[model samples]
Target: MSAALDTHGKAHDGHDDHGDHGHHTPTGFMRWVTTTNHKDIGTMYLWFSFAMFLFGGAMAMIIRAELFQPGMQIVTPEFFNSMTTYHGLVMVFGAIMPAFVGFANWQIPMMIGAPDMAFPRMNNWSFWLLPPAAILLVASFLVPGGGAGVGWTMYAPLTTQMGPGMDLTIFAVHILGMSSIMGSINIITTILNLRAPGMTLMKMPLFVWTWLITAYLLVASMPVLAGAVTMTLTDRHFGTSFFNAAGGGDPVLYQHIFWFFGHPEVYIIAIPAFGVVSQVIPAFSRKPLFGYASMVYATSSIAILSFMVWAHHMYVVGMPVAGQLYFMYATMLIAVPTGVKVFNWVATMWKGSLTFETPMLFALGFLFLFTLGGFTGLVLAMTVVDVQLQDTYYVVAHFHYVMVAGALFSAFAGVYFWFPKWTGKMYDETLGKWHFWLSIIFFNVTFFVQHFLGLAGMPRRIPDYALQFTEFNQISSIGAFGFGLSQVFFLYIIIKAIRSGEKAPQLPWDGADTLEWTHLPTPAPYHTFENPPTVK
Candidate 1:
């Protein structure tokens, strides 16, 4: 009973008593296969996300392997296109999307002192939809026409020409986007309505606040995407001229709607990472976050700015010069609020007694390298400069710096930071350190040179390139392979920690001061906060 109690010694006697024996545990494979407990749903999200991560990484490996030799040694042009398309789709919708949701599923109810997500069964529906959708995306490769060869953006006419696989991929994107909207709404309703009686908005943790911001973005952006993609579907099958220039519709219009949905989605991924690292750094640095109020305002500012900057991605699409300049300058303005965030995080650690735990290492790495990515983004923000760099390897290097080094690294940070709380077991600090160092080193080695390759006029998405670029390509391929392999170490550390490790305490780190820390255990119980603990 003591073990089962919330920190306040509250015990649940099951939601209802079925018989003398007990209430059902919702046993067998169906528990995961069909159930919707936040914990179970969170497990599904994390595993699904990891699978997507591995699969996406494999696609990258293929791209790297193909690029290993200069002249399209291993694959044809068609197959190479599929690899890039699916990799981007899988990484964005399948991997990164679910990871943030997984955090929401696991942490929101606990953090907000709710019994569970508001629509538990709908939560089940939301998660179950993912595998089917993912299968559709993956199965696109096997279809008679090959996979969607157009990029994940699925720009029209080119996409319209692709095989049956493209149709399946189209349907899959719509489905995944819908699932995300549903989940975001649930998170919104649950956080807003189900919070404990006294927990005010500002009192909520940064993680929750960021999710709140994210869910709003999701609710607003996803439907526009659904509508746009749905229209794309109609244009392909139903003879509408929405994105078909030949049918009196301008193809450029699709870019506008797609990006309307697209730009906010970037922050949908990064804001949660912002929340996660915000939590990790403060804890390890033994200080409350620096400028907590500013951090909140900064996050809100980033979200607001997301809507206005969508056109920046389309700078080279031959928009009027005035339009291009407006986007460029407005996009450049995001850096100010973003800079506020980076400054606040550093200030959080400044002059504090700090520890070099794995999470903190990853968090710090995120700050440094993600800042580099942001700077490159600023460079790309110059409309004149972007005319030269657009669609080149420079753009490739810039975004990968942002997405891979930024979002991916932050996910690793959160996992390490929260591992003890999730598993009630202590990970081997030394192995974690090794994993961190090797990953950061290899990651930089792989992508940093890509900027040079791009500026040298090497385009992205090619199966092969000119002979002059061979050496860096080879070294990059080697680094890419090493980077993927090093994840084995990360996996081993997690499994080892799960199976057997030193026991961890509720407040495993001295400075972990959240309500979740106080109310839960080293590995939190399956259902936490049956009755909300009074926040001290």
Candidate 2:
């Protein structure tokens, strides 16, 4: 018999045939509310992330609108600042991060030939914790004195002066941190302890390997963020002075602590993205991943180097020249490993049978735009150039290129790549391509000009600018609106696929060789790998 079938001719290797398991599966709303099934929780995480993405996108609209024609046409400067702050917070914690965790939840067990996450109930808890935290974060906007206007970094002193909203933000951070730590623990345990009998450590898929590294980054860094916020909270209410200059604390101390956590948090978002690209590029190229072992080493190197370069963000905040030099060199060092991964991706597609599927298109977009972002990052890595551009729109452009192009684009690619398996329905290919073209074009239209504006000395986080900077701002605002509309179209495409698209075959992509594609059925099963398939 084939590995996917039994002598009786019923599919037996945990195929999508779930008739026998129906009774055991929970139905109705409570299935999502109380269930520990990794797939269900993964679904929840994805939807939640999308919802937050829209919410954050709306805030971006407000920010863009206010800056559409210069002098604060729509919102008060204070509210504009709040929009920028919450927009960053929601997108980072609520949208991008959760989306990847969703991917991890769905793919890890299937990829490793395991039945469920290591801590199923805790998995349930980890997801549930997020809604309350999101509520706290969003609700802060309505609290007395409005939302915390201190950037997402929640810098001290300013944070200490904010009202009840700051408390809500702090508490929300605490809850979110708890959730991340729990999720990391679960991921680490599952990947480390639950692989199939013959799948050695180095034998795992690139996605699994990337996530393993990200989980450790989360475990190491989340507590630091929690501690930073807790100290801010105490300084606010208890007269403690961890960041209060009057109490012998230096505010710059807060920058040091926050960046230590912050820099790793950047990779906590980007590394999984690198993993997604790793999987998509290889599959679409119809080739095995180039330099698989080197990719793994490069990922680890990036993580290790992430810790050494936190002070780069602090160079302009008044570091000694020696400190600046060390950080400058350290920041530039990240490019080496990042370059290796980029080289391997291109080499994977070299002379290969390449096709421009939606996933592949987005992966290629990520490769080009993310590398552009990295180059700009190198420009800023120099202490002298950074001193000139810190807090300018140049810095803003670099960040979005890395973030939107790097993380968000890869996320879109992963969604499209796995959508067939997840929903057992193929999306409208035409619409998928439309979404890609519109997003990539408008994304560049929005951010590319910001580089020039920053070079001309347009500072970020401000509502208005001088007339000299007006044209590029107008161009950026228009592009922002167009980019926002493209994402809405993306939503429509996803819903249409799930409800009325063509049914997908069991193996949708010929080049995909993971266990989920090779051994499981389309849409996957309520239970998979009940009996693990040993890897060669």
Candidate 3:
């Protein structure tokens, strides 16, 4: 991951080149609204994702509050279902996916030695599409019959019978899909065509490699999702029977298509996270990443295998013995490449000059918890085990471990790792560390107990539970509130860093050797590589 750059023909700062017509950056609110600069757009993506994170987190708090006791306390069961559905939808599409795209917008060009995204104008449009989609999603709650409660998967017959809000939800999903496809196109084009002279594909950073594979996954699978929803829309109104059982369509067909996309969608979120951890672990360990070529191969392997394992989610949906066996073994096959990634990260840190900076701490946290998530996933991959725990809180605990600990924690690590480059200042290290500990502790408290709850035969997505489940639910709820507050503290740390932190030097991390750290200035110039740096 660490490569030296030839300093010959060094690129000039963007602000330094005015030519005949001086550059005129837009002022006030319009600066953000109209800007084509990658940094400006990335900032907007980050803030937007954080906003959605809060919205989703608030929904989670309500859920926990109601589940704090054994009976219904606040929301009606229908509304409770809506909260779960919307929270999952908002966090996955609105928060996690966009957050990585934000990182891509900010980092990919600079890391690969390109001046900007391949299509800057399209980049602007990609971001602008998100708000309308988000509005549609949020507004669904206010409509007659409230939001669709068919779960985040928005499964069949139930979705067809849903009210006007399902229409809104479907349309919102369409818009979000459009936005992702455009962003993926931009990333793929930029990475493939825009590398500096002499920087080959093999020479790209692990983060770049991870995203390159991820973008391919997005381009392929997002359309499948779009198709699934479109079919659902047609069944709802246009007399199509794509998923309508009464109209001669098999509802199970919807599960086939949805999980085909859904399983890869899991990787689509996770692969980029793997990329971030790959970068963080190597840098803080003060070692060049162990087995860079192997990591690339492993990532590609995961993407290829992701398509083969979708049926594991549908084991209890009733397939043949042969079908179940194939899906089970194929699903377990994913663990091999995933295990390679985990091993490489640990090997990268083994007996090296180590540091526990906030970024490193979070990366370490991701390593432990994400592996735990993978183990749980393995447990779920068995046909018999999944039949027993299919819709239980165990399933909930497994994925939250994967999504929250895996993706969200990695995003935190990336932000802290690059905060100096973005802000041109140092955040208070103590406060940042405090934020991390609170998050990891509260995070474990919240989700770990759910595994036991699932094992004890408690089902998920219900507002009420049997009396025996009350104590763990209370513990989980208390931890949920703490986790939510810890994020609030994180927002404070970021604001304080932007406003009053100490000035940063050109290179903050001694071991960070990418173009952004090695060739670019602190608070990287708005434009870079007007003349691409030569890689020796």
- TM-score on alpha carbons, each prediction: 0.95, 0.96, 0.97
- Evaluated at residue 248, the lDDT of candidate 2 is 99
The predicted structure with the larger lDDT, 1 or 3, is 3
Tens-place lDDT per residue, model 3, 1-536, is 00000011022233456352123655556666786778778878888999999999999999999999998999999999999999999999999999999999989999999988999999999999999999999889899999998899999989999999999999999999999999999999999999999889999999999999999999999999999999999998999999877779999999999999999999999999999999898899999999999999999999999999899998988899999999999989999999999999999999889999999999999999999999999999999999999999999999999999999999999999988887677889999999999999999999999999999988999999999999999999999999999999999998887767887788888889899999888877667777889987
lDDT of 1 at 293: 87
Residue 186, model 1: lDDT of: 96
Weakest 10 consecutive residues, lDDT, candidate 2?
Answer: 1-10
Cα deviation at 33, candidate 3, in Å, is 1.8
Instruction: For candidate 2, write residues 198-293 as lDDT tens digits.
Output: 988898999999999999999999999999999998998898999999999989999999999999999999999999999999999999999999
Off by over 4 Å in 2: 1-26
| Alpha-carbon shift of residue 497 in model 3 (angstroms) | 0.4
Ten-residue region with minimum lDDT total, candidate 3 = 1-10
Clashing pairs in 1: 424-523
What is the TM-score (0 to 1) of candidate 2?
Answer: 0.96
Candidate 2: Cα lDDT at 35: 75
The number of residue pairs in model 2 that clash at the backbone is: 0
Residue pairs of candidate 3 with colliding backbone atoms: none
